[model samples]
Target: MTENLKVEVVGLNRVKGKHLVAQIRLSNTGTEKHLSWAGEMADRTRPLGEIKWASGIGVLDAQARTWLLPYKPAGSPCLCSDRERDGLGQFINPGQSINVYAVLPAPSGNPATAIVVTPLAPPMLNVPISDEAPAGDFPDPDAEPVTLVNRRLILPAEALDKSEETADDGKDLQVNLSSDVLFAVGKADLTASANSIMARTARLIDASASTTVTVAGHADSSGNDAINEPLSLRRAQAVERALSALLTRSEISFQTQGYGSRRPLYSNDSDEGKRRNRRVTVTFAKPAPATREPVATTPPSVTGLTGTSKAEGQPIAMEIAGLRRLPGGLGLLTYEITNQGSAEARFAELHHAQDWEAYKYQAASNVRVTDVAAGRQYLPGRLEVPTDDGVDSYCACTDVSGIRINTEKFAPSQTREFFNLIALPETPGTLKVKIGPFRELDVPVQ
Candidate 1:
């Protein structure tokens, strides 16, 4: 809820088999005050100077594992409601209602329903899809919106699966080799242990569609650029030379550079951050999307048992409220948390400490969903936001601010629902959901 605002989908219908026009109703349900939503729902990436628009509202195809942003033409803002032109002004007064709409790309496979994703509300699940053309005038009309809907799908990375040393963002794959693991201290010479690592890296590059690969070296902020730059470049050159010999592909080209102390992935204030900053990164394009269409699977709903746990020695009860399939190989896990103690309970350990800086106090980042059949575990979905230095990753699921009412801690006897958007593999049967301090539960895929 965006400050006592209740949203309802009026219609989510196809327009000439190309675009989905989402018609939504925003009601100020509060009796006391007027609600000002100065484009709170706009996508932060390209918000068009925050003039109040619904560009952020998108359709989350969980099965397809894609979020379709509002449709934008070659030289126009998004095909969504614009408060300035629509005369919607700024506020929704007490007991007033207004309508807004966004035109988005139709989900591939033309499923019967989609999950409507909003910035500050819970995912609106299983909204029925109609194939009919939109009725009445649009909030932002275009002469030929349907014809322009053929815009290519340049989607952001569908998922970012990160390991201890690698991060794959669906499009580009990066393998980060720690400088300490590959070289002698203050020198560019490869250690004896680097041979096996280089061999493994050659195989990864061999499997990609990349015609050019970049091997970039970095250094921590401890040293001045004069000392760090040349050393970093030497380290990159060594790695490049080793890869040149190891790679079997004859046409592959290597581009190497060293950014000494200029681009740090983590804050340079900590020991772990300094260690991570000292590294060589090999980056290449991932293989193209498979020609074969994505498998269509109906989302399943399964019941899970109530589980109990203690956080900070304070008793809390938890249970799976709902588990449903989302498009784009995703799962929407809804769970409930009840503070059973006499005092307010803070489930402080339930979040990923590393995510605090990007998503302050995210409540569900630590939740894991395991595909029982495939024996694969997935963390909550994440999106990487690029900064001046490097990329910062944050969970794609709901955070603590959206789940809690007034504070980070849960009041005694207060029960609130939490959601986690999980990256799931195409597996049948049950999935095991794990939350810290609570017993894992087997939830059937629906």
Candidate 2:
């Protein structure tokens, strides 16, 4: 019965932006009444600050268990606020038997250690309370129990670092992609364009000579779990087949699972939210070392820039890189951009083929960039070219240059721009476009 004093993490739920909440249950199997008990949350992989008495229930009915203690844990400050700790609550009881709960907020690092739930101490009554009891007379409180539950909650795209080591052991890699890329309204079939995009991903896996690929499917909460789970699984399988054909490497293995509506990317109460929850992910497993040449890596060059005009009057810039030549005299370029000025900017337009030839005019699109932190780096954005007959005109791009520097509330300083200009095979060295206060630099098509 002493084994019941042990605590276990019974459930883990991940919230948006890398925040997580864990439900822990502690039971008292000892025959003697306990005066007090406390537990601490610790991580071996990384430093986890004290959670204190996150949550706990004092009383226990002999073999009885206390209520679950729920705790919030996150991977970054950008994901949530440190002030969230203020909303946390605690509970405590003594004697008979009880269960306890805790809320733990994680720090901004990907922790690799197991979360340990350790008991603080048994009851020590100073006023000769009825709950205090001798250790040996009651059951040994430190005994380990077999039915305890301990599980970890990992965020999507959070397991990439462990991919290589766990690839061959059937270990799992959990990734959550923006649902916007994987599904259409109420549809399970893979979009032809989506297939095309994932084809490149499959080629990468094949090039790595991976042994197996696992695709996990997920859906939003628009429907019941019964319907969403099977649907998600089907979506996963569909991706596996498409990827298999694209890579044309049959030696690689595959598996698919459906998580159903149990896990959602966003709140499904809104259409936009539901759309963000439908997604399928692909994880690759590396094969044993073999006599195969390493995949070739070529640094991509900057080719061209897709230009646009903004009504906001704020200066805008785009940086392009990873330029490569395509079949039809077309070029490809990818680059990173940033808003260096005080004002916000966005992707406003692109020059299409017909528009390019007819009026030497640029077709316009609307995109906005905001949340310009004083100093912070962001992921790079990509752009492709040879204009897709106006079909694939818009691509989301991020602002990443710091050319604009000014203290004035309305005026912007010098706005630096970056762009990869893709052009026809014979198009001179490079083309340049000046829209608003930003200069668009196009590189020679490689």
Q: Pick the candidate with the highest TM-score.
A: 1
Candidate 2, residues 1-446, lDDT tens digits: the string is 01234455543333332323444455544554542333232211112233233332111111111111222223231111122343322322332333333323322232322222222222111111112221222111122221211122211111122111111111233344434565565567776557545765575576565677778888877668888888888788877777877886667788789998776544566765565456776676422223434333553345445443342565444444434433222233333334445665443343221111111112211111111221111111112122335211111121111111121112233332222212222332433323223454444434
TM-scores, each model vs. reference? 0.70, 0.32
Per residue, candidate 1 scores C-alpha lDDT tens digits across 326-369 of 54445677777788998887776567444322442354666777
Model 1, residue 263: distance off in Å is 1.2
Q: After superposition, how far is residue 79 of candidate 1 from its true place, in Å?
A: 5.4
TM-score of 1: 0.70
lDDT of 2 at 187: 65
Give the clash count for each candidate.
14, 54
> Whole-model Cα lDDT per candidate?
0.70, 0.37
Clashes of 1: 14
lDDT of 1 at 45: 44
